[model samples]
Structure formats: structure tokens, C-alpha cells
Target: MKQHPLLLLVTLTCIPAWSLQADAVNGGIALIPLPDSSIAPEVWYHGQRVLVTGHDGHWQAAVGIPLSQSAGDDYLNITGSSNKIPFTISHRDYPEQHIFLNNTHQVNPSPDELSRIHGELKQELDDFAVFDGTVDPHALNLTKLPVKSNQVLSAFGLKRFFNGEPRAPHSGLDLKAAEGEPVTAPASGRVLMTRQLFFNGNTIMLDEGQGLISMYCHLSQISVHEGQLIQAGDLLGYVGHTGRATGPHLHWSVSLNGVRVDPRLLLTPALNASLLPH
Candidate 1:
């Protein structure tokens, strides 16, 4: 039997059983409980402060496991505590994809383009690392779909090869849409960046606070500005093939603690709205 994709928006007063809500595989989010405290406990992993939410002494660190992480036991450093909290993750294999492009530059860029890409990469890293501890992480609602089209172009974590050369694994979910289709914000967040680059083209990065953020790429138009506060279901931009894309599509990426994870794992479908195709 197939199960309907449901959105479980958790509240701080009552925490859900950690295990059953989300998978703990690589490129996934793990909600690990912390020691009881009167307030939220600050958790750190790999020198980055992880997102800690919930209240009334039942705090949990929402750790974003890197896609390259191995399936093994890991621990987090909680401030003011000498003991480390432990957690385990299982392994999951993703399939590979080989894409053919007629333009060789799309697969391999020139020296000048490479230099531009290097600068862009640095800016992208800085954008992803934006973590505002002020906003309560729980206040961010991320269950909404960024695109209404049910046509998903690609899934997350697919080992991808372009023009017979291997590239980075797909870090975002790509959705097929019309050239002028409207893209919406899935949560309430402040815009961190809006830029046009070599690969992503017109891009918008949103900070959902507490080290959680999202990115919309390959956009034809950008409606919001940097530091703009946007509500859920608000217009973000129009979808198009602005970057190194084969066709009109939207690339949606979700990150936690500077790590990109599977966006599907964070989204919940509405009534009769199908989840990403298997």
C-alpha cells in the first residue's frame, strides 16, 4: 500500500519521536535529542553550529548529514557539556545518470569561465553559511512546494556525468516548468542573496534561520531582493532555463548547517498533490 505524503509540522511543546519522522541516511536530516535543559541547547558539528529547536527542556539538534558522509556512528558537541551525544546513520545508494550536451562549454568551461566560477563558488559558500540564530527555527514552515508543476526533472544525490565526464552529484531537485511559470517560496525566510552567475544564472538564496536555508536556481526572473522578508506561497520568480540547462526547469536546493540535503525529505505534499516521482 502506498502512503500519502503528509506534512508533520512539529511544535516546540511536543516533540515527535525522532526516528520515525525522517531518514538518517546521508544527505538527510537527523533530529537527535539533547540533554534536558531549561532552554535550547547549542549543538555544534564540524565547527558549524547546528540548528537546535524545541522548548520546555526537550531540545533536539537538526543535524544535516553530508552526502559524502559515511554510514557510521557520529557525535555532536553540546556547549557546557563534557559528554558528546551520539547518533548513527545507515547507507543508501543513489543511481547514476549520464547527460549528453551538444555544447562542450556547458560540460567543460574555458579558463576565464573557470575563474568566474571559482569566485561564484566562494560567494555561494558564504551564502549557504548564513545562519541567523535569532529567528526560531520552528517558526520556519518549509513544507510547501516551490513549484506547482508535478514534472520533476531530477532527484537529489544522483551521480551525474555530463558529456561523458563525471561532475558533482545532483545536489538539488529539478522541476520541469514552462518558461514563465511562477515560482513560490515554500517557507517564511529572509532572502540572503540574489545574483546572476555562470552556472545557476538568476539565483535566490533564502535563510530560514538557525542554519537552515534554501536556494532557487536557473530562474528567468528574480522578484525578491537581498534581505527581503518573504512569506510562504509568495512569488519568488519565474522559471526558465537561464543557466546551463537543457530546457526550462527550476533547481531547488535545501541546506542545513551549510550542507545540502534532499529537498523532498523536507517537503510535504498537499491533498492529492503527488510527491516527487520515484
Candidate 2:
């Protein structure tokens, strides 16, 4: 087929538009091409410091993107500099049934009671909201799974739809375990908060140095308390559906600085201990 002059001109014009569209679907995975000396030595996401690596004249960061981050386009604002890079997130559709709870327990609280419970829960979250301060990214301590069971009832970063209305994304990984199952700490940290909330029931929040913390919710009992320093393998509580739930399970979550990151990211193959909050 003979290429017409008009057709060739139009194709050239469309090339830039096509490239822009391609970038939109590719997510925000890219190397920072700026020289390491030109870039600020640190970057953070949701208050948790990111681990940036420089190699071969390129800068890379192992950014811990939060599960609560909404899907679609996102951006990372380089502090102290005007560098802003765009990133895209492909939509992740989670089935609606996973988050719903069925009424079964006679001990279940009424609507008014549940509201009171929520109020208490809010207070606990407020206590864990302290993430300010410069941090060394590699200072955070990380470890392997404390338990051998891998059966997950719900995953982190799930977009929740409650009763056909969109709700906040689930912030933790839910593991189904028998009532009264042992709940162990994933790493060494200080107990920041322990309380019975409306949604989380018996909750334990552990601060692993710096601003990094881990939370365990819906427990049958809390064994730790505020200002208490705990070591790895310490019993924080017993797994049970204390808060709102369809069944007994443990909700395991990690908050870097203050941003909730993937719990699995803190674990290693041997389940050995590592990572000290900077």
C-alpha cells in the first residue's frame, strides 16, 4: 500500500499522544535519573522513610506504598526540591463479600454500644499517630512470620465496600486462627497502646523504634501495656474475634512511621529478626 503524505503527517502527530498514554498504564516504577549529589538524601511516603539506593549513576528507592492509598494515578513529591514524578496504579477489584460480618454471637453489642466502641478505637489510633522526626530508613527492625499458619481470610490493601457503599481500604492482613491462639510480636518494640475498641476489640499497638509500629487487633486478651518494652516472640495477646467480625481471627498490621505498609515486606524467608527503625 502506498503511504499518502497526509497520513504520514497525522501519524507523526499521534506518536507523542500514544507515548503519554503508555506511561499512564505503566505505573510509577522508574529510576530517578538525577545525580545522587543533586537529590536530597531522603524521601518519605505517608511519613515512613523510603530506602533509596544509588547505583550506576541512577537513584532508586524501595518505597513502601500504603495499602490505603487509592487506586489510579499517584505522585511522589520530592521534598526540598521541585521534583514530582507521576505514578499510576492499576485498579484492583476485591470481592465485596470478604469484609461483611454475620451476626451470631449473643455478646454482640447493639448499635449504640458499637458507636461507643468506635469512639474508643479512635482514641487508640490518635495515640499511634506520632510519626514526626528524621529517620534512618534502615534502622527499622523487621522479622519473619511469627506463626507458621499462612491461611489468610483477608489481605492488606483491599478496597472495601460495605453494604454497597465504598469504605476505607482494609489496613491489615487478617489471619483466621482458633479462638485463644497465641499472638506473638513480629519484632522487638515498645508497647505504645493497648485497649478495647469498638471495631478492633482488644487491640495492641507496638512501636518498633523511631516511628515504625505494628498493630494487632481483635484479640481475646491483651498481655502488654503502654510504655512496656517487648521483645520478639513476646505474647501481645490471644487471637480471637473481639471486635467486629464474622469469625475469630487476627488482624496483623504494620505502620511505618505512620503509613501502613505491607506486613510481608517486614518478613524474611527464615523468619529471623532484622531491620532497626532509623
Identify the candidate with maximal TM-score. 1
lDDT by residue for model 1 over 92-137, one digit each (tens)? 7899988898878878999999999999999888888778998764
lDDT of candidate 2 over 1-278, digit per residue (tens): 99987775454333211110111111122223333543335555445454444444445444444444456765555567677656655544444433444543324567887688667757756655655333323223344454446667776666776545566677777776788888988777778788877677788887765456678988988887898978778888888887676678888886643556556555553432222211
> Against the true structure, what is each candidate's TM-score?
0.89, 0.64
Q: Which stretches of candidate 1 lie over 4 Å from their true place?
A: 1-21, 55-57, 138-143, 269-273, 276-278
Candidate 1 clash total? 0
Candidate 1 C-alpha error for residue 78, in Å = 0.8
Each prediction's Cα lDDT score?
Answer: 0.81, 0.58
lDDT at 80, model 2: 71
For candidate 1, give the lDDT of residue 53.
70
